[model samples]
Target chain A: AQSVTQLDSQVPVFEEAPVELRCNYSSSVSVYLFWYVQYPNQGLQLLLKYLSGSTLVKGINGFEAEFNKSQTSFHLRKPSVHISDTAEYFCAVTPRGTQGGSEKLVFGKGTKLTVNP
Target chain B: NAGVTQTPKFRVLKTGQSMTLLCAQDMNHEYMYWYRQDPGMGLRLIHYSVGEGTTAKGEVPDGYNVSRLKKQNFLLGLESAAPSQTSVYFCASSYTGMGPETQYFGPGTRLLVL
Candidate 1:
């Protein structure tokens, strides 16, 4: 079974400081990866995704993630973060294949990103 | 557009009671999903609908039932609610269930089974 692991449960950073949230996955087959953000009391919003090609994937709000196949990791990062960027982040993976089967995304436990001013 | 909306932003149910949570989307998506968000467990899929009249079980579907009678609506029912069933429910939809497709989410419904 495909699984995702978010290394950090909480990460606190000073305002305008760079940050990195580590994510790793275990899958036997080819997989697609994604990062999602959830604000306080709100639903999730897609940050970025890695389907194929381009190891570096850029997402909304100046965030980017590098998909390293060898490491089985897709880590999210931002050059600088604002107070509004403080939210819970999730890493999800979906194994390649949709022929008469569920193509559901398997999510990690989540990392709470806190941008302190 | 309203995008995706879930009815009854919050609900409290007693054990053994039955209630249904409704999820509606306006994007004309062919794929809809129901997931329960629990602390430390992340989001686990309970059920999904590929199209109208077709529903499938997901990773965690034992305590829930679903119906997709209409293209825009997906209902999740708990025949006999349990305290363990309490969690934040999210509804998501995508154009298709293929690789890398984005799933638009609803605000979510907080259900408490007391």
Candidate 2:
């Protein structure tokens, strides 16, 4: 079994300021981590994912995340934020075995990012 | 291309009323999933299907049932609606079983129970 935890519940930042959303996970086996963003009343959009080979992964919208195995963390970061970046972000994880099917994804409670101008 | 589509964008249900939400994907993907999003909480998986005629339970599946009669479609059913079941429902699809699992999501259906 795999579970994810997002440290912050809400973060308010001024536009153009840098932001970091922390995430941690617990799993007995290898795991795959992902970050997703949801706009107001909209479905989720994939922010980034950490599969293998690279600890730092980049995604669309100038967002990036670094996977640290020892720390059990996959934190998302952006050098600068925009007002349009205001939304809810979720971190998810799944184990890496056959029994760990692709059907299941354990998610964090989510962190609401409010970018104010 | 409509990667994924969910029917009934919004609905209001009374207690004990039953309804089914339909999700379809034109991507010919091998994996499909149903999830619910609520305030303060992130999305939780309700059910999923890996292929045609195959279904599996997810993190929160007690109040829901799912069917995958065909590869292109997955249906989520509420046998008896309850206030606790009101949330935004999303459907997603992925292409394969490994590496950088990028699942494309639908627009989502907002359901309110009163």
Candidate 3:
């Protein structure tokens, strides 16, 4: 089984300030990582994903995440945040190499990001 | 495309009552999932279907049942509702069961059990 841990439960940042949300995972086999954002009363939206290749992957809304295999981390970062960026973010992971069966994603508790003015 | 959609945007049920949530997708996805969201919990998988007529239990499947009679529709039923079952429900669909496939989600249904 795979599991994800988000170090922070809530993060608050001023508008135009940089922010980072930490995430770590545990899996016996190789895995794929993803970041999803959800606004109030809305469903989740894919922010970015890390399947393979470059350690650093970029996503929409000027957000990026770095996959650190050794550290078992996939932290999401943004150089600058806006009020519109305030939302709950989730980190998820699913193991790779699972053939002929459905692979489910294990998600972290979530980190609520509040971009204040 | 409409992507994924869920019926009954909001519902209220009493303990011991029964209700079903419907999910529909137009993306021709082969994999569909049901999940519940709580205050602190990001989301927990309740049940899933890899294809039509194939439903499987997920991380949290107890107290819930699912059916996938059609490729584009998935149904989640709560035989007996409980106070603990009150939460936001989300449905997602992906093109395949591959690890890298992106899952598209529906607007979500808020259920309140009193």
Candidate 4:
């Protein structure tokens, strides 16, 4: 089984300010990481994913995340944030496997990002 | 492409009432999932279907049931609604479980159980 932990329950930042949301995961085997964003009353949309390759992965809305293997972390960051960026962010993970025909994700407790004007 | 869509964007049900949420995907995905989202608690999988006619319980599936009669459709049923079940429900689908497959989500359905 895999688990995701988002250290921050909420993060507030001024407009155009940089922000980072911390996420860590625990899994005995290899895993894939992802970041999803959900606006109020909407479903979650993919921000980015770390399947393999470069540690730093860029995403839409000028957001990026770094996958740190040793630390078991996949932290999301945005150099500059806007009011539109205020939403609930979730981190998820799926184990690397072939036994199961499909994979189910384990999500974190979520981090609410509030971009103040 | 319609991607993923869920019916009844918003619904209200009294305790002990029964209802079903429908999900459909046009992406020809082989895997579909139903999840509930609560404050501070990210989405938790309630049930998932790997393929048509096959459903599996997920992390939280106590009072809920699911069916996948067709490959592109999945339905989540609440036999008896409870106040605790008043949350946003989302549907997601993925092409495969193999690796690097991203799950596409629906607009979500908000159910208020009183």
Q: What is the interface RMSD of each candidate, in Å?
A: 2.1, 1.9, 2.0, 1.9
Q: How many clashes does the backbone of model 4 have?
A: 0
Model 3: lDDT equals 0.94
DockQ of 1: 0.60
Q: Model 2 misses residue B57 by how many Å?
A: 1.6
| Window of ten residues with lowest summed lDDT in model 4 chain A | A95-104
In candidate 4, stretches whose alpha carbon ends up further than 4 angstroms from where it belongs are A99-102
Q: List DockQ for all candidates.
A: 0.60, 0.60, 0.64, 0.63
Q: How many clashing residue pairs appear in each of the predictions shown?
A: 0, 0, 0, 0
**Arrange candidates by lDDT, highest first: which order?**
3, 1, 4, 2
* TM-score of predicted structure 2: 0.94
Question: Residues B1-114, candidate 2, lDDT per residue (tens digit)?
Answer: 778999999999999999999999999999999999887788888998889999888889998999999899999999999999999999999997554578889999999998
* lDDT scores in order: 0.93, 0.90, 0.94, 0.92
Q: Which parts of model 2 have CA positions greater than 4 angstroms off?
A: none
Candidate 2: residue A38 lDDT (0-100): 86
Worst lDDT window (10 residues) for model 2 chain B? B96-105
For residues A1-117, write the lDDT of model 2, one tens digit per residue: 778889999999999999999999999988889999989877788898888888999998999999999999999999999999999999988787675656657789999999999
TM-score against native, each model: 0.97, 0.94, 0.97, 0.95
Candidates sorted on DockQ, descending: 3, 4, 1, 2
Q: Write the per-residue lDDT of candidate 4 for residues B1-114, one digit (tens) a residue.
A: 999999999999999999999999999999999999888788899999889999999989999999999999999999999999999999999998665678899999999999
- Give the per-residue lDDT of model 1 (tens digit) for A1-117: 789999999999999999999999999888889999999988998999988889999999999999999999999999999999999999999888752223568999999999999
lDDT of 3 by residue, B58-90 (tens): 889999999999999999999999999999999
Which CAPRI level is candidate 3? medium
